[model samples]
Target: MSSTPANPPTALHEVWLIRHGETQWSLSGQHTGSTDIALTDHGRAQARALAPRLATQSFDAVWSSPMARAIETCELAGLGGQRVIVQDLHEWDYGIYEGRTTPEIRASVPGWSVWDSPVPKGESLLQIQARAEAVVARLLAASGRVAIFSHAHFLRALAGCWMGGAAALGAHLYLDTASISLLGFDHESRAIRRWNS
Candidate 1:
């Protein structure tokens, strides 16, 4: 009798990253870090619309930042019941730059960018990268599909880290509010299957 292959190839794992719906600060182009903000009506609708798409897939785990906007989006997306709060998933601390837009900040310091410039008392790019790496490690250690609800900057950083790139690489990936992205393997190499959808 022929025997089955002993070492079967395992299925590719996926990490689905979801950015929280829009908030007033997000709309105003403000740096909203460590701020407890609620979503707008349109943002709520955006979150609700994600449910159908999410329902199409079976996630082995669901995670969300402790921030209200992220948590609310998880709830509206119909995955709140299964979500585990991850404080490290919170947005990068903007420090004194909090509530100020890049342009506004640039008014004083020409061409200031969170990705390129340092925010006084805020999280450094390296610091945020470390957090992203930690999350990526956790997800990689787990089996099957996973989902995460978080903010824009943090999600971008996570995507960069997933691809084995520095968090500064996030500056090249533009993510919209309430968007969906996928991180998976490409023939044994980590890859971004989809982005900012």
Candidate 2:
């Protein structure tokens, strides 16, 4: 039998990660998780602005968090028909911290930080990291470019995982509402192509 040559490596695909538009709680700096809040009027406008930019790209698949804000943002961005709701893309579960601002949490628990402190009765950092990893794995297994619409904290965690870092690293990445980010491999090494765009 003749020897066969190894197959060439597949080219890396990009994943477009978009943070959902602003909500009443997000505008107020509240920790919104599992609250099912809707986007504000300004948020709708912001999402609409993304339509032109997103229209230029051809995504093989589009995923979104089950939250209304994320779904609404996807719709306003003109990608509604392509969206497939993914539970793993949902925001962090805030539990007792839901709807509470950082200042308020600090007032009750001095020097408390979501990244540094434990969230009482909420999802742990490990859990968030696991979810992010799963989403990344699924996207990598798929063909062509992918788009994901989700929340700030969760998307930050996903970005961290994409860069082969722990979820805590997400604290260093700040994501604003209605923001668009890109994650792709650079010559076989994972990289953040763009952030907070």
Candidate 3:
């Protein structure tokens, strides 16, 4: 029996990745991982700004990292009632690098980068990738539009994984605070619809 070349690619759900707004550590360029910090005043304003943009679309589900920053952003973005906390969405565990800036880390090890360098006593890139992949799997299984509010590094990792790339690919995805990104299928292939908006 002959069959059509592979069936047409199934349309995938759309995912909106939202990076939490500005925080003291975010502004200061600190690692800010696993620190559970809150958003700054301007950060709150930034989150409020998201409400209008997000209101344009209706999401089937809204997810947030357990961190205060992500939770607050989700709430301020007018999704608090629908926000579901996902631990896997939390920021990378910086460990020894926690609260340290890239410049500070590079002072000792020149050109050190989180994507390539080892995170001593902390989650490795592989570990972060696993979490990201897990979350991606869940999103793929779900229907309709989904929104996630999380930290920068983790969200970048998730984006990379969503595109079937390694976590290190996040090195090239420059995410700004309070930015929104969209991920969905491009015809038959997984693609980034819009990014860093």
Candidate 4:
């Protein structure tokens, strides 16, 4: 009989990424960043719904964005006591573009994209990418499963970083409010186990 190793090289751990419940701005398709906002009634219900889904899972660590929406979601999901607020998990700072809709921004600057266009006095793509990478690093180091509650764009950037891609690639990942995504190793390779659930 062969002896089994204490720690298998193929051991897989999961990082659960959850976008905060819907806010008024989210429903209105507005750019929400830095400006703290509250969740709508439906959003609260959505957050409460997550409790059952997460009840059975055990997480080594739980983290949340400092923003009210995210913290509220984390609390409603029954992980508030376990959550450690991470400032870097906050959504991308949109600066002058904050609370504006994409169409509104386009009206002023044609063909402007949050991913492609620069936000005046706001965080750069590199800055967001760096923060995502830091979060990924911490998640990867966790001994067991970990959970994070954050914003849509921030979670998208985090997923991109977990897959070893540039933060700008997050534009391709469309995440809905109060959705769940899973990131884990697939036979030693980074993969998205689940998305926008």
Measured on C-alpha atoms, candidate 3 has an lDDT of: 0.88
TM-score against native, each model: 0.94, 0.93, 0.93, 0.93
Q: Can you write out model 2's per-residue Cα lDDT over 1-197, one digit (the tens) per residue?
A: 11111211143378899999999999999999989999999999999999999999998899999999999999999999999999999999987999999999899899987776889899989899899988877766676788999999999999888786577788899998999999876656677889999
Clashes of each: 0, 0, 0, 0
In candidate 4, stretches whose alpha carbon ends up further than 4 angstroms from where it belongs are: 1-12
lDDT of 4 by residue, 17-82 (tens): 999999999999998998899999999999999999999999888989999999999999899989
Error of 3 at 148 (Å): 0.4
True lDDT of residue 43, candidate 1? 92
Cα lDDT listed for each candidate: 0.88, 0.87, 0.88, 0.86
Per-residue CA lDDT of candidate 1, range 37-150, in tens? 999998999999999999999988999999999999999999999999998899999999999998889999999999979899999999999999898777766777889999
Give the range of the ten consecutive residues with the poorest summed lDDT in model 4. 1-10
Candidate 4 residue 118 Cα shift, in angstroms, is 0.7
- State the TM-score for model 2: 0.93
Residue pairs in collision within model 4: none
lDDT of 2: 0.87
Residue 193, model 4: Cα distance from true site in angstroms: 0.6
Model 4 TM-score on a 0 to 1 scale: 0.93
Candidate 3, number of clashes: 0
Over 38-80, each residue of candidate 3 has an lDDT whose tens digit, in order, gives 8999999999999999999988899999999999999999999
